[model samples]
Target: MLCVGLDPDQQKFPLSLQGQANAIFTFCRYIVDATADLVCAFKPQIAYFASARAEDQLEKLISYIHRHYPHIPVILDAKRGDIGSTASQYAIEAFERYQADAVTVNPYMGFDSMEPYLSYAGKGVIVLCRTSNPGGSDIQFLPTTDGSGEVMSVYERVAKSAATKWNTNGQMCLVVGATFPEEIAKVREIVGDMPLLIPGIGAQGGDVQATVKAGRNKNLMINSSRAILYASQGEDFAEAARKEALKTRDAINRAR
Candidate 1:
């Protein structure tokens, strides 16, 4: 599945929409309209809207997508994780407040931190595993000993635990970066058929073909952010985005 990330940056938007109050929403709307047919889902990164203090616009954008393209799910890339009570609020924010179909969450605080999200049986709770950032290796690659006296990378452990223990609701998914196809393969092997949300493919320079080869199981959501959203700085931005998105979707299909 192709998941387009609607992470709008004021500095990167087309010149005409840069100073508008609904610039982010407008840009996102065009992108969604252009690629809705080709994508299985849309991911709106919370930080982009929150940073600009445009939560209202974010809500409108999500509502617009739902109202127009009801079939494509929206995964809010919030990466929220906290204690039970706090996690509950975050869960409400992602699933209730924003009405997101799925949310990206951090698992650093362990299972208890994720229980609140897990309680929402109908909503997807995607746990962060091997992230796409450069500093992801600082923690994700560390070796840890499981209770069975077996050693594995922290990400591998998270994958195992998420797949076995925390997936009772069958709504759990893992976020494995496309930048690490080998790790994607490893996580896919550990988790079997569980869905994986793979990012880092576009502007992050992740190899789409390799990512597909390693993570493809017809259960992966390959996301592209800046590459599709900011495909052009001109008025034809939406068309440019569609071209890029179509290319990406076709590439993933071919790789599969």
Candidate 2:
């Protein structure tokens, strides 16, 4: 599935949209309408909408998409992962409230913190193993001694666990950034056939060819955000976004 992250920041939004909620709605609707055929899923970053209004309104926008475009799956990129009962509430908010088909989660909080969301049968829990950020290497690449006294990177351990242990129900997936192909390949081997959510393609300078060659699996989903959504800053932005999304989607399919 090709997932497009719809994060509309005020600073990046078209100058014409200035301070209009309808503008945000219109921009997203047109992009969704244009690119829905190219992609299997749409990921709307909750922060983008929440930055404008409350979470309830953001939930409504999600509901609007699911109601109108029932065929496309909606993945909420909230990255919700917390301790204790907070995880359960987040599950409720993401699943019961927004009805997200999938959600990106942080595994740093450990397995128990993720249990609440992973318990669901049909829903997907994409754990962040290696993010698409330059600073991500700071922690993800840290070396730790295993029980056998061999040292391994933190992300390697996470990928191995997610493949062999964490995803008992087959709903768990790992987030492997496209920016780093070698790292992506390593994680792919550890995670085996598990689905991978790959971000950071256009604006982040990730090579699409290398990303697909290394990360393509039966369940891999190559994600692009700013490249598609912000393809243009004018009235024809949505059409521009569609063209870009199609290019990315076709490229991904060919590599796969």
lDDT of each: 0.93, 0.84
Off by more than 4 A, model 2: none
Expressed as tens digits, the lDDT of each residue in 1-256 for candidate 2 is: 5888888766666767777656667667777888878887888898887777756656766787888888887888999889959999999988998899988899998999999998777999999999999999999999989789988899999998898888989999889898899999999888878888989898887877898778755677888899998888777788899999988988887777
**In model 1, which regions exceed 4 Å deviation?**
none
Candidate 1: pairs in clash: none
Which 10 consecutive residues of model 2 have the lowest summed lDDT?
52-61
TM-score of each: 0.98, 0.95
In every candidate, how many clashes are there?
0, 0
Give the per-residue lDDT of model 1 (tens digit) for 1-256.
Answer: 7899999888988889979979989999999999999998999999999999999999999999999998889999999988999999999998899999999999999998988987887889999999999999999999998589999999999999998898888999999999999999999999999999999999999998899889855699999999998889898999999999999999998888
Best by lDDT: 1
